[model samples]
Every structure is written in C-alpha cells, then in structure tokens.
Target: MKMIDLTGTTGVIFGVANHRSLAWAIAEQLGQAGARLAFSYQGERLKENVAMLAAKLPGSIIFECDVTDDDAMARGFAEIGTAFGHLDYLVHSVAFARKEDLEGTFRDTSRDGYRLALEISAYSLLPMARLAAP
Candidate 1:
C-alpha cells in the first residue's frame, strides 16, 4: 500500500465544537494523510469536547483558545510552536452567529448582533492566519 508522506507536517485545527463538526472532519482527513494534529477550542465546555474528539487521534495536543482574545490566540500558537517547533498547515473552521440571528430575518438583527457575528465569524480568521502563518 502506498502511503502519503507527512513525516514532518503538523496541522492545527481551530474551532472544533463536537464530533460532527467540520473541523473534526478535516482533522480526520489530515490524520489519514499522516499529519500530526493540534486542536483549539473556544472555552472550557468546548475544551472538553475537543479533548474527547482528539482522543481518537493519537498524540494530538488540545488547547483552550478563544479567537476573540488576541492574548489567548497568541499564547495558543506559541504553545503549538513550543511543542512542535514548526507547523505546515492550519485549519480554521471557526464561525459564530447568535441563535436569533440565524433564525430570524436580517432586518430584525440588532446592530450589536451583527457586529458580534461578523467579529466572531469573519474577523477572527485574520488574526488566526497571522499568528499561525509559517
């Protein structure tokens, strides 16, 4: 059998909420390709979820990181670098929207709600990229 070589490749997956998440799916594919895994979660609740999901992927490192916090994001990436020295790929599946915003019309969305959604769903990716960039 021919195997894909990922001998030195390291992958960091951000925003894995549960087993059914897109992040989890990507992590699975990366694992299949022999990439080492590191995972980040938003909070304590999600930290537990990520840890559970990561257990199936051997040698995976899981960390708590809220993308909205620059310090937390920086520390997370720094920790990953400390652990792995270098990284080859970073997968971002982070997105957020309030339940009301998702269910109701855009006209009904409050200004704060819109800002929150954009900040979490769209803007978070920029810093994540900057910090994780090789």
Candidate 2:
C-alpha cells in the first residue's frame, strides 16, 4: 500500500484555544502528516494559548480571528493566502455558548444568548467555508 503523502499541503486550523482543544489535536495530526499549518484565536486569552501551541510547531503562523466579525475573518484568510499562497485543508473546531445555556432549560435562555450562540457556532461555519473555498 502506498502511504498518503501530505507534504507541501497547507492546512488552516481555527478555534484552537488550549492544549486540550480538538483543533490542537487535528493540528498535531496534520503537522505529523507534513502539512504546513496556520492557526486562529478568538481573543487575547485564546491567542496566548494558541501561541504556546504554535511554539511547538516551528514556522506555524497564528492570527486573531473572531469569526463573528466579517472583517477579521476576511483579513485572516487574506493573510493566510498571502503567506502560504494556497490551502489544501481547513479545520473548524471552534464553538461558543453562554454559561447559562450550557446548564439550564431552553426556556430560560435569553434571546440574545440564543442569537449569539447560533451566530458564533452555526453561522461561523458558513463564512469560513466561503473564505477558504477555491
């Protein structure tokens, strides 16, 4: 059997906030397979975590990308494309939910919380796909 070769492929990993995050795990797998990587964080706190993880993978680039913002998302993909030229894969492992909604009845959830959750968790994927598409 021929081993699948991933060398020279570029992969962008979004939503890696900590060492234990799924995005981090996917990045490790992609890196081991010889894919060049880029990572995005939601904020400063997450950026710190992503930076620490990126340190383990020399040459990996990290960016601050709040998926809810169109400009930030556009800038992130533009920077990645400019830096890497092309991307072969994009991993979206980010999700958000208000603490109250995580443990309470749906009836208790506020309208704003519900809207925010859908925007961040569901709608975010659409923009990522659009930006990453060839």
Candidate 3:
C-alpha cells in the first residue's frame, strides 16, 4: 500500500463543530495525506474545540468565518491567503437550518429560515471560491 503524498498542498475546511464532525474527519484524512490545512470555525463558542482539533495536525490553523457575514468571510480568506499564499483546495461542509424549520416538511419552513439555509449552505461557496481562486 502507498500513502498519498500531498506534501505541498494547502487547503481549508469549513464547518468543523467538533471531533465528530464530518468536516473534522476530512481534516484528519487530509492531514494524514500531508496537506497543510486551515479550519474555519463559525463563532467564538467553537474556537476552542476547533483549535484543539487542529493542534493534532502539525501546521494546522483555525480562523473564524461566518458564512452569513460577507465581511467576515472576506477577512477570513484574507487571513488564509496571508498565511498560505494560495489555496490548493477547499472543503465546504457547512449547512444550517433553524431548529423549528427542521420540524416538518420543507414547505412548512419559514421564508427566513430557508433563506438563511441557502445563504450558509450554498451561496457561501461563491465568494470563498473567488477568494481561493488566486
């Protein structure tokens, strides 16, 4: 068997809530493959947890980025650019819906909740992709 050697690869993973998050699993695998990684956490509450997980992988960094906030997204990507110069890949595992919105069928969801979900889960990729393009 051979291990994938991604020694010079650089990337970021979004939406890591904890060790159990699928995004975290991706991060671990990427790390094992020798990809340098940066993780984007949503808020201060998750900072400690994300930081702890990132520490397990050498050279990993954690930054705050709220997909709903364009300014924050810009700043977070800027930080990553400043740190890594360029990105080789991105992992977007972010998805969200209000708890109430998940209670019933999609048709029963409130307009605001649906919009929020779309913005966080789908629209966020656009700007992040643009930033990572260079």
Candidate 4:
C-alpha cells in the first residue's frame, strides 16, 4: 500500500475527549498519512486517554488546554511551537452544551448555560487559531 507523505507537515488538533471522538478519528487518519501531530485536550482527566492516542502516532505530543482559559491556551501553543516549531494545519471539533439547552426548549435555557455552551463550543476556536498561527 502506498502512504501519503506528510513528513514535514505539523498540526494541532483540539478537543479529543475520547477514542470515539471526531478529533481522534481525524488524528488516526493524519497519522496514517505520516503527519506530525499535537493533541490538546480540555481537562486533566482526559490527559491519559489523549496521551494514549498520541502514542499511536510518530512524534506526537499531548498537552492540556482549556480553550476558554487564556493562560492554558497560551501555554499549550507555546509548548507546541517549542516542540514542532511551526503549524501547517488546525482542526476544531470541540463543542459543549447543557442538557437543558440541547434536549429541551431553547427559551428555558439559563444565561450561564448559554454562555458556557458558547464558550466551549464556539468562542474557544479563536484563541486556539491565534496561538497556533505563526
């Protein structure tokens, strides 16, 4: 079988929460194409699982990044730069929602619930892109 060469391509993927996650699925494909990958997860609880997935790819690194937090995003991308020196691609498969917001009427959703959902699901991408951009 012929494999695509992504030998010099570097990328950071955000929001790989589990093995079944979209990020993980894309990561598996990227690895098979010989891409250098860095994975950023939202919480420490997911660190082990993310690390395990990262181990499957050659020269992959796992770092903690809460997309809503300024410091964490900054630190994580800094570490990525130090590790890979540059970024060639980025993927955003991160999202979050309250059960009330998702399962029921939208009018009944709380303000904090809307904020939290937007923060994790949408606004988080801006900082990630900024930091990952060279």
Best by TM-score: 3
Backbone clash tally (model 4) = 0
Instruction: Look at candidate 4 and tell me the lDDT of residue 70.
Output: 93
Tens-place lDDT digits, model 1, residues 1-134: 32676756898998789989998998987877777889998877777888988888877898888887999989999989988888888887888988888787889988888999888888988998898887
Alpha carbon lDDT of each predicted model:
0.86, 0.87, 0.91, 0.87
Candidate with best lDDT:
3
lDDT of 1: 0.86
Sort by lDDT, top down from the best: 3, 4, 2, 1
Q: How close is candidate 2 to the true structure, as a TM-score?
A: 0.91
Per-residue C-alpha lDDT of model 2 across residues 1-134, encoded as one tens digit per residue: 22465788898998788888888998887787777899998877777888889878766898889999999999999989988999888998878889988777889888899999999978899999999999
What are the models' TM-scores? 0.92, 0.91, 0.94, 0.90
**Model 3 global lDDT (CA atoms, 0 to 1):** 0.91
Instruction: Report clash pairs, candidate 3.
Output: none
Model 3 lDDT, residue 28, Cα: 94
Tens digits of lDDT, candidate 4, 64-128: 88887899889988888899898899889998887777877888888999999999889988887
What clash count does candidate 3 reach? 0
Tell me which residue pairs clash in candidate 2. Answer: none
Candidate RMSDs in order: 1.5, 1.9, 1.2, 1.6
